[model samples]
Target: MCKGLATLPATCLKSAKDIKHKISFLLQKPEPQAADQKQMKEKTAAAAAAAAKRVPTAAEVEKWKESFSHVMNSETGRTVFTSFLKSEFSEENIDFWLACEDYKKSTTSKLTTRAKQIYQQYVEADSPNEVNLDAATREETRQNVENACPSCFNEAQKMIYILMEKDSYRRFLNSKLIQDLSQTHSDTAQMKKKKNNCDCTENRQALAGGA
Candidate 1:
């Protein structure tokens, strides 16, 4: 039977090798055409041009500076600022702050370290809850507990819940701080406009009285 099978398989062996070679040939990627290369170069040039055109205006810089100053100076602003430092600012920016001769490096380092630690804690704690473990028998018990009572999933579940709560609270505080700052700036602008209008009205009245 083995001799008969080997003798009967020459055609099948050739067909299989042909199919394998065809698959290999199909899988070989084609190099980019000259037109594709030209198009990529044009795209790169256009992006560079667009980037070069984007210069910051003096007014925009001043507005940012004012907002930064307000946030850094006031107590509520300080809290918001710290949160922003924790959430928005990049490590490079944080490093720049730490590098400032006037600012204490230890304080900046502590804030940056704390923010990173919290962020890591939040990510680690949140990820486990999101993982789909339906295929795992061990996780079936966890799934059952989750279904029965989400509050009963042990330490990992509790940690995730606490982290989520902390994140939500931080987000709320950040939003409120932003709203307050926006309102304060808007009020200041309105008051200035009102004062200017009053001055103009007074000047016009005095001119009419003199006339």
Candidate 2:
């Protein structure tokens, strides 16, 4: 009877241990699920990275380069083209043509205004010796010509004009250009030396001038 009783308790203990082990295993199963989730996330991220690495087509780059080359070559043509770009035209090519039209209109207006002013001055002249009206008008005309010349304008406007002429071309220079240009590793020692030299010269000049 004693042996039977002892065997019953031992069997119960073994059953309880087996149940505990099964419960522990069930609890630990979520760990593998978490690992699997992490692995899946890693795989997904890798795939996305690979997709992002896809290079732009060679043909697209070539087309852009060709358009840029065209704009850089022509000055007057580019300028007239860019003015249209700043306007309401959707197509770049059309915008360039529109810019040309606008330029023509502006030029005509300026010429007409200048001519009328000159004619009025000539009619109102008090004497032939009192500054020949024609000579004064000629000088005025020359000055106007200098101001209206393309060389007198800013380079940005010139670039814009080129972009306007060729729809495929675009001038991307801006603050970004400055940032890119400034990214070089500068020599601090050289800069300091230049600054010291400039300061020294300024001080000597100030001393010599009694300032």
Candidate 3:
């Protein structure tokens, strides 16, 4: 009998017994195999991580090494460049460029409407997506919107391109994100060279053995 059992009601004694049983169950040690499984999992994870680190993806190698024009021409480059712009809080720059590109491609009937939309959204002072243009460029764009030609935004677009090329372009090249990509490309090239050399040597060895 427990020392406090005499003072407790029947219901209370039953509750105390349940609590003690639960405590004992909770205190029981886990199985040895469980620990071994956990260790094995950790080691496997480490090995997989090492393997992944040793191999760089082909897309990473290509995207990082591409020329600016090549990057702008493809959807992948646009996405990557847009992400870089967003990080710098200058996504409007790309938006303006894309808008200009679309504007230039529009049919004559649609050119006026697209040009106005581009100017109002990206050229006017204090507009939500305004590009960082000088006063002369902004004034010229404002004046051009009234006439709204296909080439109306040309000068402004050129300025924004120069801005991105001089500023964002350099930062992107120097960024750690791009640097890592460049490194991955270099590593991938080295790996391919080594693999080709190994294949050649193996072929030579087989030929000599056959002879």
lDDT of all predictions: 0.36, 0.35, 0.62
Cα lDDT, model 3, residue 161: 85
- Candidate 2 Cα misplacement greater than 4 A, ranges: 1-61, 67-101, 105-107, 110-211
* Best-matching candidate per TM-score: 3
Error of 2 at 180 (Å): 14
Per-candidate TM equals 0.27, 0.17, 0.60
Candidate 1 ranges with C-alpha deviation above 4 Å: 1-79, 83-174
Q: Say which prediction, candidate 1 or candidate 2, comes out ahead on lDDT.
A: 1
Clashes of each: 0, 3, 0
Q: Model 1, range 91-202, lDDT digits (tens) per residue? A: 2222222222111222533434333332222222253113211234224434443333322223333333343334433453345434444444454455556666767887
Judge candidate 2 against the unseen true structure and give its global Cα lDDT, from 0 to 1.
Answer: 0.35
